[model samples]
Target: MDSTIRTAIAAADGDDPYRALRQLHHARIELTRELDRAEALAVRRARTAGASWQVIAMALEVSKQAVHKKYGRG
Candidate 1:
């Protein structure tokens, strides 16, 4: 999360607590989306780095073929 976002949330609370809470909720949702994207990128990169599909699948609790089906080629 960005420090600027935290500051904005803190300021929003000073004006209206409920609105600030809503703002925080929206921020959290966006943050979650961004984190998901980053995680996916990292997984792809790890696979490219020579990590085996079976290893990735085990960490993700899925089958090796399942991981390959989604990200095997690229």
Candidate 2:
């Protein structure tokens, strides 16, 4: 959704439209993985800083049980 990514996709679409869309989808997936990694790191840091699962879950807009299940054992 970023302007830079939009520009890139537009340029790519000018060449081979389908290939450009596929590449953009792949890029979005990769970006999502990176974001997940960053979020996990931040969660770990928050836990270390004495933040509770409920607090983290509230910040993430997810259930506390869900957050705990995801990060509690790991």
Candidate 2 C-alpha lDDT tens digits along 1-74: 36646755776858778777776887687678878999999999999999999999999999999999988986
User: What ranges in model 2 sit over 4 Å off?
Assistant: 1-8
List candidate 1 segments past 4 Å from native: 1-4, 53-74
Which number leads on TM-score? 2
Writing each residue's lDDT as its tens digit, candidate 1 over 28-70 gives 8888889878867978888789888888888888999987887
- TM for candidate 1 is 0.59
lDDT of each: 0.79, 0.85
Q: How accurate is candidate 1 locally (lDDT)?
A: 0.79
* Per-candidate TM-score against the hidden true structure: 0.59, 0.80
How does candidate 2 fare on TM-score? 0.80
